[model samples]
Target: MNTPSVELADQVARAARYLRPHIQRSALEGKRELPTPCADFDVHRLSEHLLGSLVAGARAAAKEPLPADAPTTLTEPPWVVFPPLLDSLAAAWAEPGAWKGEALFAGSVRPASFAGTITIMELTVHGWDLATAAGRTFTTDDDVIATATAVAAQIAEGARARGIFGPEAEPAPDAAPLERLLALTGRKSL
Candidate 1:
């Protein structure tokens, strides 16, 4: 049987393939403002943040030293950064053995594998953010959604206990597993 981490990685790859084309064609209006689920970020900033996270995760998975000037704040569009970032992510995931159970950086509380899961969550949610900001819609494969749904259900259980979601935000009555996944992660739609 596949480990949950491996399964989540596969789901993430599927979501990334589904998202890559849309990300490439997305018109990232540099100066124009657009809202995002991440409170401090507008569209451009969020894209940059996503790319930065991807880069970090990829590097960590490779067991490489992080760049000295790694971005601390969001700055660029995903379109400009995703190609290399995605390549790194693919390489990291394709590597043999388990890196997820390893520690992330010097002082992370969670294992590197959990960090990978968070990266997957970030990609899925940010893909939704990009599409929403661009006035477009995107969908994931059902298999990916099923896996994501399982992950999201676990997250939602913890988030609910911690009161992380807002009162106005509720999972739709008949939301698909992916939709619920997104909703649990603070994205309104799938």
Candidate 2:
């Protein structure tokens, strides 16, 4: 990671830890065929994508090659089994220079700056998707939101063009941070 980007990158880990439980209990789980907050992915599709990306994100953080495909679901209580995976991810990135350079993702050598921010985008927005599908609340401190928003602003348009995020839908003038974050990612908060 770029020196200044380290702090924001760390936020991705925090967001992941914060959202894991809600993902475990997501109402969208097991209903793999329903629509999600994102226009392209339905519940089942997003769930699978989320699971695979968790594994991939860890790999990216570790400076390892991301596998072509990752699994969408686990037996149960991944909160217990998945910690090691997350631990590996955290540990990989914990290295002094883990974020020092560009990382491989989906067969592409993405810029160093993209590694953490994209992870934050995927986890935070998809976590919100799961939480919303479950009729739950997803909260974050101002700093996390700031980092997420900043990352969104940096790459959201590119993501949209690449068919990652949906088309931009502006948020209300007075929308809160989380709401602004969601809208930037093309998910309406309301």
Candidate 3:
């Protein structure tokens, strides 16, 4: 099998660092129960979901089998678990062979690059979701924003059908790239 592209793997690593600050305990204070743009998920629930997804992404990158009954929700404080989970994901994807073949994602076989790209999408989008819920400023480099925008567009239709994303909401013409990306994922930028 051909090696998975390093480009997306690098993006995943950058994304992990990009997301770390947003999930800090101090940033999330008093905002645990606040609702986010990601429908039905408050800040805390979304945090748990993000962490769980990171675990799954790491397993996928490492070509490890997913547990039959992995818990979707986290019992531990998300801020505490978030950094390490991000690190795990980034490190797993950085492995030279990680992207060499098909990997399991959401119980289906997909190109390793697909899994990595999706992970990047999750980190950026959910990072925005968490920061927005906490009334914190959210920002990322233009390249990351561009990559996320492309991913959001690629997955918008299928993701909506799977309930991973809601129906697309159009952003204002003058909206920033990050806001436009969020709109594609059915999130209203604050």
Report the number of the highest-lDDT candidate. Answer: 3
Winner of 2 and 3 under TM-score? 3
The model with the greater TM-score, 1 or 2, is 2
lDDT of each: 0.63, 0.70, 0.82
Error of 3 at 110 (Å): 0.8
lDDT of 1 by residue, 1-190 (tens): 1456666567657767766865673456453377765545677777766767777777666666568787655454566667766876866865754345564542254566665655666666677777776777767777666555555655676666665443225677997766677666666532
Candidate with more favorable, higher lDDT: 2 or 3: 3
Q: 12-44 in candidate 2: lDDT tens per residue? A: 668767777665634445655556687767666
Q: How big is the positional error of residue 184 in model 3, measured in Å on the Cα after superposition?
A: 0.8
Q: Candidate 1's error at 44, in angstroms?
A: 1.0
Candidate 1 lands at a TM-score of 0.76
* Model 3 lDDT per residue over 1-190, tens place: 1223677678788888878888887888778899998889988888878867898899999988788776677777777777778878888998998877889888899887777778888989998888888888877777677777887788888889999888888889998888888888998855
Q: What C-alpha lDDT, on a 0 to 100 scale, does residue 63 get in candidate 1? A: 64
TM-score of each: 0.76, 0.82, 0.91
